[model samples]
Target chain A: MSDSTQVAATPAAPAEVPVAVRRAAAKPVSFGQVVGRSPFVPYLFLLPGLALFVVFFAWPAVEAVEASFTDYSIVNPLHVVGFANYTELFHDEVFLAALGHSLIVMVGLLPFSVAIPLWLAILVNRKLRGIQVFRAVYFLPVITSMITVAVAWNYVFADKGVLNWLVATLGLSDAPIHFLLDPHWALASVILVEGWKGIGTYMMIYLAGLQAIPGDLYEAAEIDGAGAWQRFTRVTLPLMRPFMAVALAIEMVNALQVFTSVYVLTQGGPNDHTTTAGYFVWSQAFQHYRFGYASAAGVVVWAILIALALVNHRLTNGKQANTP
Target chain B: MSERQVLRRRRGARWTVRRIGVYLLLAAIAVVFVWPFLFLLATAFKAPTQDVYSFPPSLIPRPPVLTWLHNAWTQIPFPRYLLNSLLYVLGGVPLFVLISAMTAYPLATASFRGSKVMFFAILSTMFVPAELMLIPRFLVANQLGLTNTYAGVILPGVLSAFGVFLLRQAFAAVPAELGEAARLDGCGEWRVFWTVMLPVVRPTLAISAIFGFIFIWNDFLWPLVVLNDDTKYPIALGIAYLTGISGTDTRTLSAGTLLSLVPIVVFFLLLQRQILEGAKGAVKG
Candidate 1:
């Protein structure tokens, strides 16, 4: 989310302590000083972590890019195809459908990620009793495994389950609608589950933003005869821009990488109607052993993520500068 | 005085109504979030005669039974799967936390030659989607002969930027003075890190551990990719397997799913105070 960077940069203690003590202590002379002051010590500290990173992230990332250019079936040695996989992907129906599906999910999640969660944050941000308990209750979904959540919702989306019952009772539909089995409803249903599970996360992020806002700003606005809506529009929303930016960026990444829910719930089923880019990669690589093709799709997914991230970065950057 | 008192009384009445409205809204939202789990709980206990799905969908299991729970356990090696999960968490979380702390220590305290580069390098890893890395990572593990093994599942997860980033924040939050004091006492960087720095960030370590536990416990895709043997399947995958076997029987599936969830949920509830605070602090960034 880049939230780590933002949070890490916040200096914990006030800068009352002078730099002299730190500098002096950093260069303390002793037998240990021989080891401590060496330029190699930091590398020593970083060695194990960096080694794991090399083996897992760095090397594999390079290999993934490399494999994307090659026809590397699991049963055969790699053969360089020179963008054949990518070109094939352009015409691949499932790949195109997966791309479209991922976009739909990404777009569909905005309300839950941005708007509803903001409202949720505001509601739970009140000074009512047992508020934390309610916050925890809402966050239960986020903590639980996606498999468990998917299973829980499987019944909820059953033809005669609670959702259909609610729809029928409200006169929203004429009959009980099959949510997961119907191709039109499957992707939307999965997206809803993804959104529902993630609302707690976004809510907490917005809550932090809401709480950071000084109450005196609201009190001052009230004194000036601004009602709740005016205070929210004038004071709260503007101040929460940075938090929303972070949330949006995170949501885009999360929504793009949605796999567990799709795997557990729909398996990109009902004629590939629910195959996301992430799920497509898995299907290609694991299910079919099309390593090169999967790597190519993976590269596409990576490119899309980078593009979205850059766009979000620019948007948030401009807004944040204007605010602070 | 009477006029002012009457106005004050009316304001109090309005506030009460508003408070009641707020509570109702909160309750409604809570129900939306909690109902699925409650339904899961009910279905897991429902007797065979009770309809798991009906026109109105009854949640109360008339004469709940444990037959399904017994079936779920016996049908699959549920205990074995649980043990595999526990093994992954135990083997993975500690190493994950330690590596993260080590990586964070230098970034927080030292202005090394390549510290900035190192920090960005680690942060950049977050951008590499796990979905993309799945194929290549599995290949690397294959080349290393780690496939179909515990190390394959656990090692790759230890290298996450989330842990390093969170610990970096915690380590940086510690005042430089504590580090200085230890250094002045002739402590080496290692001693300073182990005795001086890490202890101060113990709560952050605990937070990292909790996160690591939840992640390794619930992890599905990577483990699914790396491990081929059914015997090595963790509980998350186990639940998926159980569903595959009992496709139509809601009772058995619910019991298995519920069983899979209980451990982590209980663990979370027990340590919820700390976990929630950690969550808030994480997003406060």
Candidate 2:
């Protein structure tokens, strides 16, 4: 049986054909022909994945939309309350604060997610020995669980933690800042951790963009007597705009949904200062069991995300067109 | 010295200085990335008499001890949680890869009637944020009698847009000739796919598996939502549980957290090259 199978698998017949002729002939014979001409075979292959997608994603999405309009809870009988949740949410101080906090996290993350990562990528783009080791070290936090990150940083943010030690030793502050306890510092502290954990990912994205740039472009800029900064601005920046857009878009989405750090670091406490829109949705549904209200808030957050993505798309495209 | 030779030596000195400056800068930034974990490790092993936080932040333990590690292990079902995490990864990743590959195979190799539509529809799932899906997906799982079960945690996560997207790209890159030759040998589509196409994309398959392993291992939120029983909690969630109970004992918390990180970190160290390369490929696609 093994001998027969081996004999049948030989490709000697196709090898005899001229390369160009074989290439031309191969174009018409799709893999479906090899699959015994069954039109249903493809569907059969796709069935399991499509079924899971529908059950988990599509159905849940539709239910989310429908649940937003109803006063649904774990205990109560569902009743239609069209737009009341939305109206109330706009007026709700906590929800609005959460939205504002999400925005703050987004803005706070910009330097880490964009600027610093770009600089790091450029620095690491060299063809030096031990560079890959440095790259892996930089990316270590991105792979570690957020729970672990939060725990590790707890030591860093303790009353007498390294950060406090630095501040005090540098004479920046006489007293230690309550990094996770004070309302003023709590959200910012969470943002700092979020940004720190995320720099590696953004750096990797920028490194990918950097590696794609041809060496000749830099050589050409050098031949023109362009300095390093001038070459970066003239040749690299324009080419990297698309990557920046990607990094910015990802950072925005991540910031808007900042929950794990908030959960682990502050639990959205100290007067709800760290309460982001993502955390609000989770707390409302799971903590309060207000499924409908949470769904409404979720829909609003989803809308904002989509709108921001669209605005980002337009701005990136507009800038691309404006550049010489 | 000749004028040209002096000029050359001075330029070379400056170049060496600049290279040293770059290395110093890189090492400094790497410290920023690595210091937290190092501090965690130091705190975990520090003797009980030693202060975990101090002026200037001493990172070296006076004498490392295993007391906290033992406490972390014995305090709350640590081994059980680790096993649960292993179970989740083992249960989820294979299905994730297999489903992704099976789904991608047809979309890439055959021109079915709705292949394009199917691809786009699946791809759009990436935009639906997990926060948005939380309530309804939980409800769906509840309806399916899946909540509070391992399947609930594993099933919804097994099908991700990233996996499908990555595998589709991989499958499409396979040459058509291999599949054709197998077919000419009177092999069926399944045989062709199993023997020819799949082997050709083994590197991509390994990449997907590595990503899947990392994702499932580090996942916290969904498992937190799905599992009501503490016994079923994965290591990440278990560490959070440890933090909640161990409150002020930073040493024990650090030890538990460090313990949870070990497997994933070792796995990453072994496969960092593939991971870093795969990350670039993922973005470009």
Candidate 3:
């Protein structure tokens, strides 16, 4: 056949060609040749995700920093104000209180996220019948929407709800405590709700770690005459340190991002006791229409998170543990 | 019986008692974890005349009625909001999974330059707190004219570093021989990836899909910030709005909350195994 006829008669290549064509021909027609050769085939695969990361994450993150310095409203033209927003954030009492409350919630949630979940993990780790059922039940809250969780907790926190009834029946107090309405109790109640919802996640993480421990270790410990508590303390606790580090990191991230519960339960209210840093940022941006100022506060919060993460890293000796 | 036999019997009795004690502990903790939901279910069905909060805090609904559910259905655009949430989940999850897979494929198999850089870049995004990103992300969407649009919510959510990382691990764990076999058969890299590799990592995809579904369905703040119009509000936001209405009663709120939770809770029940395995693999992987 003539060369022109051969070129015309050859079948069109499929779109899903490989980078290195193995076609059995003297002159191979590779995808690289057909599509114009470049070393970016891998990047071509990465383009969609990278585009999203740039537009949604990198671009916005840059804008967050820029907005923190400028006086940009949604409607108004932007003006570079040179750290005025940051200065204002320092002076803003609500911002300070919000920062304080965020820290408080983080500290408060450690018990729920680390300690109680570890306890629950140990309890459920036993080879009991229907253990999976209990696990599934415990995990229900973690999967449910936060709005539902907040609403459910609302009933339990109501003045005449089960909690108050229990307290009264126990003679702890004669009068009902308005859990969500009283400033003294609102933050604690919100923290409790957040912690309750989060227990399952941490528990599952610990359970996985517990499951990884060989049965022989426990048996060996038993043979050594180590008591139950002693086995847990000496065997399980030492083995669980890495898992705890991972859980602690995850918990810190979740606790600092505590907005949905506050929004649904208290609206960060009863005199701003539950207004976490996350809520403060939202209120500034959406409610007060201070987008620039909110961006500044976001930067501050982000810095704090980074610092805390670094500290956690130092504490954990920068171990290359998997993050849950 | 001998003294040794008596000692063995007493020890056996103590062991049984300890097992019973363990069962009791599990039962009590289960009550603590599950009671709120039970209370919610009870309140949703209780009649308006029924005291939801009595001195004893009863869970049994006396003369359960569906009136509150009906009221909640009418009070807001519940069905529309449900559709919106379904739209978010349906639109967001597959794209999220696809993008995650595409990103992970090259990172897993490609020996090209800058692959590690790309991996670390994605990892860094994990540390960028979600709350901090809200304002700037909203602004970026506005600049792109995606504000108040479903694309706005779905597109940003498509890039989940956790999904990408998990899928990367999954994809890497598949033997290299599989890809080489497909390649020798004149199957292109894309074909090898799509047909041969994707199936191997199907479990990871399912795991990410379930998580993506949960996240998108329950994502309140991002959708709240992006979509100004209440008509486009997801179910979570709709429930929040319902909670805001002064006239919305407890029974109605309870009903609305229950309705909002059903789809994902049911999903969890159906796919609990995959999710729990996914959680475990996340640590181990």
Candidate 4:
């Protein structure tokens, strides 16, 4: 609007600002000058997004901290209560059990997420037709909702579901496997679901890493009479380290927050066997009306995650300096 | 030169059995990865006797019928949900792409004052889990009187930090001289951005679009919390309703799951090639 007004008043633009001043400032700026001229433009572009980040991401985290120290209930309303919720969570056995289960699920899922995906990516990365279809087929669950995957899979693993039907027919068992309903299988089931969702994503990451390596490395090795196994062992393994690190780190952090599947499939049910730290927090805040306690749990989860991130950062940094 | 070929021939003969064995193993694993879908697809068409699992499991329905599929189609009005999903995705993704690309350009390319603070501010958001925003987001939506509306569902997701990061990486990787050359060729600032800069990163844009489609399509939590009307829900939520009734009405429920999965499956098949390329780009970028 203002630009149009200025264009309209150009003949009489001296009224806005004198042409004498304009001529003084009208000397052409250098190419180097333009790089520094719009120092504020980038900031201006970033301002709205930065504001959103702080409000939705950063501020809610701060709010979670405050909520943890208060006596908040969905039914009775919230007010200050110094350390009451934290104190309660510390003593709760089920909360402890849920926390343990979360760790167990993380442990069970980490190797599968990193190792299995990398293996599969390597196997399918060969020069072959329909490999693209294989990748797409594998990654379908990843792009789909973890929620739907959990629900559909629940039927597939049900007592009278397809898995059990197959198991019985193979003479593996006389009856259906109690995958979801049983205590022993419940947490493992959740981890398996997470691994399934993640394997495709890891495959893509590994594929990218593999593609980035120069073909000359393999060609040069082949000219030196290196066998396929020798080439893969000496070349692929070393080149793939960075990708493995990234894949491992991401899978670790993500597995900490496995909520959707647990919420939908288990609902913290079958004697609370499938509850992870995330679903535990959800149940506390939303279901049981214990916002204060849930917030404390959230804080604990955050701290643990932060500590692991720090350790990973330090280890990776150390290695980066030591290696090329 | 021929020594390499002799080595290859000897090794190929030696590893023939092993290569075939490996392929067989991979094929078996592929079958396992795909088994659930096959079962679900069959169950969607199975009759009562066919649906029920016994000692001898049936791979295919002895007499397949569309009864369950018909029931599922009518029960949830699956077509309405697809329309709602299309409206939601169409309204949100392009806006997100624009905002993300525009916002990330300066962060990536230009040298500016206080850039670190802005960069820090953006990076910090990546760690905040989506679960953390439940109450405040609800409060914000309610204050705006947008509860259960399209605005509520689409607005928050459109301004993602991940999108900004993705676009920034793309824009930053472009040669700066091309941008300078464009500017010297008599382009305006907006022209330089839209005409000169955007085309260089078409693959990144495609990646963002595919990502936006997936995340928005399958989302259930925000919709479950925000949208009350079943008709406003995306296809996944519609399927959740199937689960809600899957316990009681087995046949109809199986059909509903299949109906819900069809769009995603069709989409995967249609864009399988582009999706693979997009995945590769994701790794590179």
**In candidate 3 chain A, where is summed lDDT lowest over 10 consecutive residues?**
A1-10
Off by over 4 Å in 1: A1-36, A75-77, A322-324, B1-14
- In order of TM-score, best first, we have 1, 2, 3, 4
Instruction: Kindly list the per-residue Cα lDDT of model 4 for residues B3-73, writing each as its tens digit.
Output: 99999998998888777776777778777677666666666777777545544445587688899888888
Instruction: For candidate 2, write residues B1-285 as lDDT tens digits.
Output: 899999999999999999999899999999999999999999999999999888878899999999999999999899999999999999999999998899999988888688998987786676666777887888899999999999999998888777887788888877776777666666666666676777788888888888899889988888887778989999988898898899999999999999999999999999999888777666663
For candidate 3, lDDT tens digit of each residue in A1-324?
A: 011222232222334435455344244332233233345667777999999989998999998888889887877798899989999999999999998999999999999988999999998988888888888888888888888887787668878888998898889987889888899999999899989998988898899899989999999999999999999999999888888988998888878878888987889898888999999988887788787888898889888878887898788875554322
For candidate 2, write residues A138-210 as lDDT tens digits: 9999999888998888778988998998889889998899999999899999999999999988898889888
Best-performing candidate as measured by DockQ? 2
Estimate TM-scores for all models: 0.91, 0.90, 0.89, 0.88
- Lowest summed-lDDT stretch of 10 residues in model 2 chain A? A10-19
Q: Score residue A230 of candidate 3 by CA lDDT.
A: 98
Please give the range of 10 consecutive residues that has the lowest summed lDDT in model 2 chain B: B182-191
Residue A306 accuracy (lDDT) in model 1: 86
DockQ for model 2? 0.52
TM-score of chain B of 3: 0.90
Candidate 2 stretches greater than 4 Å from native = A1-36, A310-324, B1-12, B109-111, B175-188
Model 2: docking quality category: medium
Clashing pairs in 3: none
How far out, in Å, is residue B80 in model 3?
Answer: 2.3
Whichever of 1 and 4 has more DockQ, that candidate is: 1
